[model samples]
Target chain A: MTIRLFLILGLAAGMLVADPQPQPKLLRNGLGQPPHPQAMVIEKLRRMNPEERERVLRDMPAGRRQMFERRLEQWNRLDSGQKKKLEGSLESFRTLTPEQQQTVRGLFRKFSETMPEEKRGDGRRMLARLRNMEPDERKALLSSPRAKARFSDSERDLLAEMAEKLPD
Target chain B: MSPNTMSCPLQSGNADVLLSYCAHMLDEERTELIEQHVAMCAECFALAEEQKTVWAALDGWESEPISAGFDNALFARIAAAERSSAWEQWTAPVRQWLAGDIGWKPALSVGVACLTLVVGIYLQNPARPVAATPTVEIAAQELEQAERALEDMEMLRQLEPTADEEKRL
Candidate 1:
């Protein structure tokens, strides 16, 4: 009877400590209206002269350049659903520390560089999904054998490290 | 609107006029006309104000006047650039040769092999092509030496000498 009582108490404590996954920004807040992000960027680009635009691009670091290029390539093709999903994820990403941001950026960059073209869209979608996953679910997904086999050692390690640093 | 703005006229591409107005560079007549236009148009008014601020910022910064030789210096630079460009056009091929990325090992090996082939051909006897048997050459050489010895013996007999003299000689 005492052993069962201790087990029940332990289970209750574990449940209390467990954190639920965060809702995506669009779901938590209202959907953003136009002018949409892509149009806003295109409008800003149109306003800049060649020299001014070149200077801005030159000032961006390599990681940001890759990020900008990736988003730029997707700008025209991004459906409304994908835009809403990215918007939510971007909101969560803004809350990360600079080091964490770089780690996430590098990890995504590595994933994109190594993935086959057909799988790339799914890989990007997975990254967007990560912003809303529960800590334990993220840990399970990252540590799964399939993920271990798929990503390179350095990329997997960065992800595992990211998992460890997640707030409860 | 102000009375001046009501009767004003402005045209596009008059940014230079606005700038001159901002700097008080225009004559009183033109300046007054632009000032009246600036009072009404938000865009031109903002530009004039921004250029006026630029003038204010420049007040604290002192700059030396251009030297009288500035035009001569500019002409000299253009001439020098033209001369250098002409010179570069002539030397472009030579520069390209000097900058070629040919790897040495394979190129040098081919060059050395070609040189060895040329030298080997020069040294080889055409009468006795490489395919001619070595044994045949040695046999012909020996027969020729024997024939030469026979002729020399005939010549030696012509200088006949005694055995003791031959031994002493």
Candidate 2:
């Protein structure tokens, strides 16, 4: 009986080992290979200035430049979704008004001087929040009576003291 | 000498020459080795190609000229920061001294002031009796009774021990 029980246990272990559970498979490109380098090179070229693109082509050998051009051509043939994702980042550069850009630059300078090691994510989060708000909502929040009343008596006194130091 | 002896001397001499060449600091020999390896090895050749592509991409990146006001803005920020830091540096010691001195001053001053105020109030009261000799005699008797009671209780406590405590002894 003991021998029979041992054999049963061994058989169960063998079955467990032999019949492994299937793992979820990640979807692959139909070709089962990474995208061509020409596609990546073309995307990079689109973001570069004409002068920079000319400089790179001039610096490279004819064979390498031909390879790069081939890649650029392939990148132009990508679907709209892929193209839009790459192009969307370029909009970030254009969306800011000159004055707002100046303000952001000033904020970065202040951050560097006061806290050089500060995580960039903090500023990014604040900017994201600001960007997500409507202009009217932002203005209302800044000028609210609730904001003025939020200070304690001592804090209000401190603010008054600070305000007195400011130029009229 | 045998071929092994001759080869050993040659190998050691080559190694010495190679060491003196400083292959890492002087790139010529190292570059030759890398070129040879890349030409012979598919993996190394692929890496060399990738490196060329990365270098080309890096060369293509152009940073826009910093705005004309950038320097003025940066300097203003630095100056403001310096002023803030200077103020903090100047005030920190004063703050610490004030905190340490003020923390104890209230407790000490209030205690002394209260004592003085109590004494003044007691002296101003006309209804209070001035029988100091009789009061001192009564206080001495009360203190003696309290001391005797404490001694008697201590003695009784010492004599009484639980069964477990006795076992420990």
Candidate 3:
């Protein structure tokens, strides 16, 4: 009798410790892949009632909550396939080492925020081209006379850093 | 040997006569016949002796007497059971409904009410709300996701690393 009681208690405790929520059906296709925490939460919010959504956002500061909701609104506008690809990219970004992530983020900030607005368009175009080139080809392009004529030394450095560090 | 000296009752599959003799229920003539068979047949004598011992034990055995007020208590329990049975019969339909055995008409009414509630809710909540919404502690994990997404979105928008970055956040 005591053993039976202990067994039941153990099972109840196990259930309490286990994750209670079921995975969303939409994310089921990504089973065996690493967990997509962002996508999971988005899917959960998508299904929530107003009361539930309100409850979830109640603890967040008003400003942060507004910003998050705006970001989420934009996220919801994407088609399912596009959402999947975006989520995949986020997951890939998350898997990178902290230092690697920082490198990429720093490079991007330099490209977008520090660069002049007039040159930002050209920078994006050049980065786009560099993204598809082979490692040796990328080196050749960065050193080419055309690249030198088009971009400053600093812009070329940024492109070189991104081309080497960014994931395919 | 006499004509009454018969075959073994056990072999004949007629052990009831031996049982009867052991029980002292047989008439005098039948008892005398069984006794004659027992005296000559060692097997019957031994079985009769064992049977006699069992009967003697049974005769000495006494059953427990009924407690005082047993009849009253038993009748009271029966009456209580009958009263409960009537109450149960009266509530059986209610129990079934509570157990979700409700008919289609009531189920349809409930479903429609729930659907109306859901539709009312969906109508009130727009796809995007411009005003600030409340936050709670239960969404700590989800809150973390939002924070991380916001941070990542800022960085990702800067990089435009993906070929289709122009098309997405």
Name the best candidate (by TM-score). Answer: 3
Q: Once superposed on the true structure, which residue ranges of model 2 sit more than 4 Å away at CA?
A: A1-168, B1-26, B85-169
Chain A: TM-score in each model:
0.41, 0.27, 0.71
lDDT of 2 by residue, A1-168 (tens): 344345445555544333322322332333465433323333345555656566545655777556556545544575666444333322342255666544544443443444323332332332233344665654454345753455334433332332222112
Q: What would the per-residue lDDT of candidate 1 be over residues A1-168, giving only the tens digit for each residue?
A: 344345445544543333222211222213545433323343344345656445545645777555554444444365566445444444455467878756655554555466566544434344334435876787677677877777656665554554444322
The alpha-carbon lDDT assigned to residue B36 of candidate 2 equals 56
Q: Which ten residues in a row have the lowest lDDT in candidate 1 chain A?
A: A20-29
TM-score of each: 0.26, 0.19, 0.47
Per-residue error (Å), model 2, residue A147 = 88
Q: Which stretches of candidate 3 lie over 4 Å from their true place?
A: A1-35, B1-139, B161-169
Interface RMSD of each: 52.5, 51.2, 13.5
lDDT of 2 at A14: 42
* Candidate 3: residue pairs that collide: A57-B134, A57-B135, A58-B134, A58-B135, A58-B136, A59-B135, A59-B136
Residue-level lDDT tens digits of model 3 in A15-101: 343312333555642546744666666667766777878877887899988887887777777677666666666766887898998
- In order, the Cα lDDT scores of the candidates are 0.51, 0.43, 0.70
Deviation of model 2 at B94, angstroms: 22
Per-residue error (Å), model 1, residue B151: 99
